[model samples]
Target chain A: MTPDDPKDPAGQHETVPGTSPGASPQGGVVPDSRGEFTPVRTDTPVADPGLPAHQWRPTDVDPKLEKRAERQVAGMFVAAQVFVVLFVVSYFVFDIGGDGDAILGLGASTVTLGLCLGIALLLIGVGIIQWARKLMGDHEISEMRHPARSSDEDRTATLEALRVGTEESGIARRPLIRNTLLGSVGLLGVPAVVLLRDLGPTPGEVATEQPYEGAGLANTVWADGMRVVRDVIGTPIRAADLEIGDLVNATAAALYETNEEGELVLEGTERLIANSKAPVIVVRMEPDEIEDVDGRENWTVDGIIAYSKICTHVGCPISLYERTTHHVLCPCHQSTFDLADGANVVFGPAARALPQLALAVDDEGYLVAQSDFDEPVGPSFWERG
Target chain B: MRLLNRTAGRLSRHRRRPVAGLLVLLLGLFATGTFYAAFAPAQAETTASDAAQVEEGRELFLIGCAFCHGTNGEGVLTESGTQYGPALAGVGAAAVDFQVGTGRMPLVQPGQQAPRKPVIYSQDEIDALGAFVASLGPGPAVPEESEYSVEGLSAEEQEEAVVRGGEIFRTNCTACHNFDGAGGAMPRGGYAPSLKGVEPKYIYEALLTGPQSMPTFSNGNLTPEDKADVIAYLQESEEQPTYGGFGLGSMGPVAEGLFAWVVGIGGLVGFAIWIAAHSTRSLKQKGTTE
Candidate 1:
């Protein structure tokens, strides 16, 4: 039976333009070509889906409004250029690892660079959204559903439609916007490469750059006759000052050093990095309380001993002292060191003993280093041995 | 010639009889005894002054401290048979001076720890008490005020003291008191009180006495200069201005994280909502006017 037959019910329903995709109650009453009533089956409920009438955007209809929106979008791209330039300037101008240049507890380099880059990205995103909402062509489109399997002729027609849509987008015609967007996005890559410089100072450079010879990862600022000063205030320690059971954090006296005019000589990053590695804890116990370590008999001066503050496990400054037991704990990972027995690892994951500093009294009565720590301090690394 | 002849005669006599040699040795011993007797009074005089102070301190101890510490200051037990107070006989002068000087003892009520309060006893009474406590047994003696003071030190020495003080404070006190000396929690109910407004003299006493759970930083341990350095660090910390903005108690990362989220992110979120609302209103108004 032919579907175009005047009595066919299914062919009649397909002709309705605005009707919802469902069967009408009166559908089955229509007679078929064979003069019998046929049932029309549909899973969808019947309802009239009335779509709202399209309203024109002001920028779509008014030439002046459209011109304003185009300029506004271009302005955002211009603002993005400013932010990108700021990001580059911030990279060079701000001290990345210096004291007194922190904002919100972060380095000024970190805060300014992040803000500039973030704003640059946000501007590009906002500009694109504005361009789409106000300047781009506005129209409503609807397409009827086709069968899953397409004929050879329909596939050719779909490709032709895509070509037409691309032309209507007008991207190539708007050279000003297209060029500015490309420029801002391309500039973002420069900051990415610039930020990579923060990875760290090159290997072997730090030691060579130091003013004091042999002062670096391999050697601390301590040397023969340099007084062991208190870490912050820079006061020299005396052997007679500390009593048994007292633990004091100390550093190389070079940190507190001043020029002839009395101005601080180590004022910034150089001082910070050097002091962190050179920190040590001085503990005093009775001469009898200490166990004799082979070859280290004279390391202690009147029951006072010095050990590197850096934990061997992960290089955290270890200072939680149990005076009675002569144990010091690292808060970072619970690594415990027995100070009396040459600072041997007693618990947790540390594998080696903390480095000990040989001590002597200077001519002026303050505690001074007999020499630098015998071994490299801090966490064990491949080149450490 | 006559002296030489006499010496030869005595030597010949000693050789003939060993009793003559014994008589010479006993005479030498008697001469040494006379020399010791002349010097003994000078040493005893210094102790006599200390003994007078101890005698007066004993009377004050009976009236003020003997109730909980025992009549002999030997410590006592409670009704339940538990040791209510520890024996203070051998704690020395430093312990008594620190406990009473800081006003932690003569405690109104007993708790896990004694808090610092206004001292009830006069300064002389406190010193007398210290002397009596010292006489009971040998222990760490009280340190003089000048021992932990930077007043007479040179500019360089004073600077060194402050720097060393910071180092010592970081190593010893930061565990319980925090980096800023704002105090922090202990394992149980105890806490390290803030050192912000504490007197320097009191700080020295606190180290010497090791009030509560704090271990005594004795002359043998921290040393007088070490204690002075610690005091300098504390004073420096108080004088320092908050570098950036509000320190938020200098609680470190946790407080900073909270401020960033609430103020920074919340401001951005509020700005976004305002933009969204304004955009919708303008769009609706334009459509209606058209």
Candidate 2:
């Protein structure tokens, strides 16, 4: 075999001295596979240019300037620490919900916390930039072009190279520095773990009281005789008003309850949680249109029925109703329920029927609940024993 | 089984008349009864308190509504088989009130839909028209007078009403009419109109009649008090202050998030760019001095 092809072992062995395999020999000739020799030209049109001349920074040239630059960088870091302190102080200084703490319509607490935290971050970033530009090593370095693939020899010697590097670093002898570095890095993870507490109390911890005291997962604010009020404006619903083919979004009247002082009985998060589970849709259809589902016959007040709005499929509030078919479709997953037939799942991914609320009208003509839902409302997982 | 037994007993008792003749007689009676029930003129006028109002409404209907709607308020069906306007006979005063009060009636010309506009008649004339339309049939009536405004309630009740109204508005109406009552796009070409400056009575009537493609919120579905709460919320919302600085049109989180990203991030990026430019210029000067 002629000695030109790099892939050919016999050709590599027969290559001319001082010339690379696959490269032309000094006579500008390369051998062919059939033992014939062919002339080749080896020339490059362009030459590689080296990197530009290095310029010295002010800190690199003068000792006084170098010391001043170091002070300025340290000052920025110190200012960052001061801003962090300000952030902590602001957390306690400003009132979150109380009166006279708002600044330009935003909560004073929120504004101060955000501003301090942001400034601290900005200072830290600027300090790091200053340190790198004015004080840290700035010597220019370059590496020669080489194949990305390592040779077998270099691959085998990697462990030995690591050992030599470690020895040169003197980390094994510097016990104080090494342990302190490890301690600081490990301690940084504590704040991240501590912040996880803000995700809210566990389901078990949330109380299950009625009349607006509990978490939504276990119970709602629906009480015996609590009028089913229209959502938004706490107006009581009268049974005489609804016509056939009408659907109304309704909620428990307890949401509008106030104490003697006129403050809400269920305040803040409790109100929000109770309201989430309390949403129900009241729909009216012809009495003949509804199929009698055993005991549910008494649940309707003159052909009007109420059911929880939460879709059993992943808990989206469903209200899209097709009056002719008595089908209420969940827009999120297209889960359809036949409201006339006891709110049964008619189509799509819902695995369970919507929980129906038993209805009764008070002497005042307002629609009221006979009792709480017989079964827990929402996703089937909550109903699991 | 009981029905079958009764039929057999009737057959044995009826020996003089043949079963076929008896069957024909029963069928004729059933057909006549159904036809009468289906086509009978609405008998709601007997329930109306004011006959004079109904009489005035009839006169108004003759002058204005009868051109498209027949003199009997049965609506015209062209020779081409298209209904020029819908029958107003059984739609009642509630429908009449909503259509006329909202100024969607006296349609300039029939097309895909009628839009709300300035009313062509005075309040008295409108009421008369409503009474006339209502007198023709047994349909929903104009509800008794309601104090829909929050001014009627105690201070505490007013606050609670506003809160509840806000909750209701956000939950139900916000899907089509946005959080601030600025309406949004509906499915197809229609839109839920903005609640701004709309009369509370018109809102109540719209809920009952379900003008156009909107689903009806009947008296039983949304009680009178509930309708009042909705009205209260709509009225209160227009006056409510935007406490958290910029409202961004109360278009909800999507629009707010977009604005935050654009202006907030853009400003930050511009500052960073300015800092970088200043730093580089200073570095060049230092390099020249060295």
Candidate 3:
């Protein structure tokens, strides 16, 4: 029936076999004859499937069992509430400090918080489950399935429906779905144990490989006797050649080629990796103008010297040179390096100096490294301390 | 005719009488004036002494500078000083020339740092200026040029030179001039000039003559062409331009950020208020219609 028809409050229409309106069902409520009328049903019948033979819970059939079940459920809830109180006490009692009475090396505060909260939540979960099995209603019922989509009233009606459905489903009497759902959710703790694998890699796996040995956080491919060459060109430099105020961008010679034995020296990704780590800037001042840093008297050849071009703040490639001041500036953050004074950080965000590459002339008069940088190059990393 | 002859005879007699008297009076006045003009032996002796001093100056030069400046006081190419010093040849008898001549020889060092010092020679030695350097090859003498003379500069020339000078200044001097000519720091505690109130000659000398830590811009290194360009830039363009906004020294990003925060963002906020007011009016109108 149309909502406009006042007489048909249920909004259901009834029609004669051949006519469009004015129809009624036998023994149902009939509307007026004015053509804006229809029939409505007040009591809808429920189809029934007969109940199975009674197999009652021990609590339901015997009064002694019922009293015991009530005590058992209450006991679980009381135990859960006690654990919650213990959780609060542990938060204040733990002193995580240098004494190191930590659980599993975690601070006392961390261990206590995790354990107390975990046990508190677990006991409460167990209490609620015990309550349902021992004390909640138990019965069997049959219901007809309704359409999946619900009316606006169904939103408000869902609680009642769930209650009725629970009675029919016999979740309380069966105990299987109830106990297993509770137990499965509770046992989720076991996988947390399994996930502790991510805490650190196992001792002797990829970490034990020799390719990464000796090289730690603070070292690179730079080393003694390594020839300094033009970065991409790979031609070695003789100190006598650079004019005053000249700046040359160079890299370690090892980045360019391998030894004759056909062994992959500077192999695969190593050359690409070493190229980044070994970048250097060589500047020439007048021989008399060079200021010698203490203990680095021989670091320069005549007046030519090399320094790591990587800025110590964030490892930006730096090449801006003010020849007159002997200050090499990083364009990225303006970190100024004093090339004459051991490439010390004179200004800007850099925490440390651009590390100087000690230079010595080989027998052939080509510039070679006396040794690798005394300290690490590039942005400071954690182990730098 | 008879009367004329008689008058001539009378006039001749009168002439003889008056001429002799007039001649004696004239001679007496002449003697007094000459005696007054030429005084006693003491005055004569002072005059004679001055001439002697000048002669002595001539002699001193013969002994000292004549070997290089010739016997007639001309400069000698083969002289000891010639190997090092330029021919003083025609630097006139000026105070500056005199300062240079007396054992100043080759300067203790070149460049702008040269300072004025005492002459090692006597006054007689300095007085020889006319006979010594002047007697050498004749040429345009050192003029008493003014210390400040950019006045003769044409506006167009000043503008062009200043622009060109700025370029050269950036390439060569900005490292020291600091882009704004504020004079940035230099290596080993040296520094460049402030370019403020610096004299033209000092700049010329600093360039032609390398001073202290500044490298020499000899004709060989920076051609006169380059020096002129630098001078033009330094003299004319140094004053801040009167643009409609703050210059902030033409230091790029720092000034731009200051401008944005002070002007651009401020304008945006002001516009936003105006727009908000307009929007409120429109919203009120729409509400009334609704």
Candidate 4:
């Protein structure tokens, strides 16, 4: 089957015998022994009925103009090399944050390194294009048709085309474009190598800055005295307000803030993170019904106690309350906890009990935290073991 | 010799008095025997009627419960003295009916406490055996049907009863069972059985029976209709469609997010990748061929 046949799977286009695929069928166009030639057609229709005779560019006619174009292309390549060098220098000179020099709100190292690397790549690209267009082969060649598969002759022809293209590009004759094109591409490697320095120091500095001391994956904003409040509304709960069997979804007070107008403030990602971490399930039982944990006698005001709504398994919030049993169930994975028994894991895949938030009645009678959780809340961690 | 013979003759005459004394002692012994026979302890001599009831109850207890509880109601003690079947000595008739009438007594095997099973014993038999056991020691009594019925409650009283019932539900029920009465798992293989679809009578019986892991709620603990009110709430909650989209097991947001993430996002990512690969191949094939 012919390569260009509609049903052909491979991309090769067929060539007619006696003439190349690009040869004109008219006399004087190259033809083979059969005296027949295949005409090549451009995709565009003969608009303007074929334009006025093509005007030769200056470089096509004047050798000096071509030489100057080659030189200009080479200059771009040399400049690219300079920027690559600058990229390496900036890597060493800039103090990422140790010295704290900021450029346009970014660290000096980041801006300088990025700028130099970008310029270096851009110059390399421009230099190559200039060499190809201004000095590369302008003359076209035609060959006789052959089979689609690359025969020995076709392989030799391809190699010849590549050599012809390089000569036509004038890389050998025009030292300026040739050297700059080579230099620019070679320099491109410098930016790539210099950028490696940015990756640095294998392990990162321990995140020991503000709000993150010794606190890794297991820690959150929860601490002693953090009041349990409604998630978005931030309203503090009074034990008296909740009747028996009521399940209130709540979060830590720190999740909410007040605007200047005294309006509640919870916005963006901050609100989302706080809501996820501090979810609490509040339930009211008979005072007698609560199985008081040792030393947590006053944890509940009246019969209301709050426990981390986050499941001790994979952290699904639990609100399925079986009041008669004083059990709160994590619906995900069916982890059941006895709220009365310190939210101890009574069932399911949960490895530990839901952490109970020790609660107390403030002077104003609102429920407040007596203390942070005695242990970490949510799923157990490897470090914790 | 003549004086000794006369004294021996007088002593022989006095022998008549000794024989009369022997006859009086025999009469006293007969009278004591009759008195003792007349007033023997009432409990020891089971009357024909009491005997008949005890015999009937014993038959029923053996047929229905003796396999695990033991033939004599002493409970089958293991070598370690750990009794698998609790001794029924002080567990009164109420306990028996609550257990057996609720179908919780004759457990096939220990599981998450057997739920109230259908009673295999007749009411009269349950009571009779209850009495027999109660005779052993004072224990919790089974409540009559009358005790379970709420007395002449006004609208306000009913409302208050329900409100208190809600309180009880939150405190005791909400832990293992959901606030909505959906059942939850318990420690080990046990579970807090769902309150949903449970009949009010069944709820009352369950509380009374302490079926399975559930602790019994005697009259001293939760009144009968108090159980009824909680049952009522559970039934009512079931009838109402949970507001705001699907309840997603009524487990709240985290599960919803997980469903969305694992199931929803996973499906989306899979679909996206399929579409990407499909479109890339199809579009490129179309471009190259056509």
Best by lDDT: 1
Off by over 4 Å in 4: A1-310, A314-330, A336-373, A376-385, B1-59, B72-74, B77-84, B89-92, B108-118, B133-138, B144-147, B163-167, B174-202, B216-228, B232-290
**Model 3 agreement with the true structure over B1-290: per-residue lDDT tens digits:** 99999999997788689686897799999998888778876698987876665576567656655564456644456335433223354443432243443334324653332334456665455644443444454522322333223346688876766676676666455544566665544443444556655646446545543333444344433445556667767766555442223346545577779888989799768856764553111112112322
Misplaced by over 4 Å in model 1 are A1-212, A221-241, A252-276, A287-298, A313-325, A329-336, A341-352, A359-371, B1-94, B103-128, B137-176, B185-191, B208-244, B258-290
**Candidate 1 vs candidate 2, DockQ winner:** 2
Candidate 4 global CA lDDT score: 0.66
lDDT of 1 by residue, A215-331 (tens): 567777778988998666577887887766666777898888899999877767777777777889888888998888998898889999999999999898877676546877776
Off by over 4 Å in 2: A1-47, A50-241, A248-280, A286-308, A320-385, B1-87, B106-116, B139-146, B150-152, B163-185, B213-217, B265-290
TM-score versus the correct structure, for each prediction: 0.50, 0.54, 0.33, 0.38
The superposed Cα distance between candidate 1 and the true structure at residue A123, in angstroms, equals 19
Worst 10 residues of 2 chain A by lDDT: A6-15
Model 4 agreement with the true structure over A134-167: per-residue lDDT tens digits: 6675444455555465555777899999999988
| Candidates' C-alpha lDDT | 0.77, 0.76, 0.61, 0.66
* Model 2 chain B: ten consecutive residues of lowest lDDT: B279-288
Chain B TM-scores per candidate, in order, are 0.67, 0.65, 0.37, 0.62
True contacts kept of 4: 0.02
Here the TM-score of candidate 4's chain B is 0.62
Tens digit of lDDT per residue, candidate 2, span A1-385? Answer: 2333333333333224434445644444455698665434333324335566666666776778889988999999999899999999988887765433367766677778888999999899988988987778766789544334455577669978989988998789899989999999999999988888668764444434344354546677787898998776577888887777687888899898889999878778888877788889998889888888888878889988999999988988877665546777776677889998888988889989998999999999989998878776788653355
True contacts kept of each: 0.15, 0.36, 0.00, 0.02
Candidates, DockQ: 0.10, 0.16, 0.00, 0.01
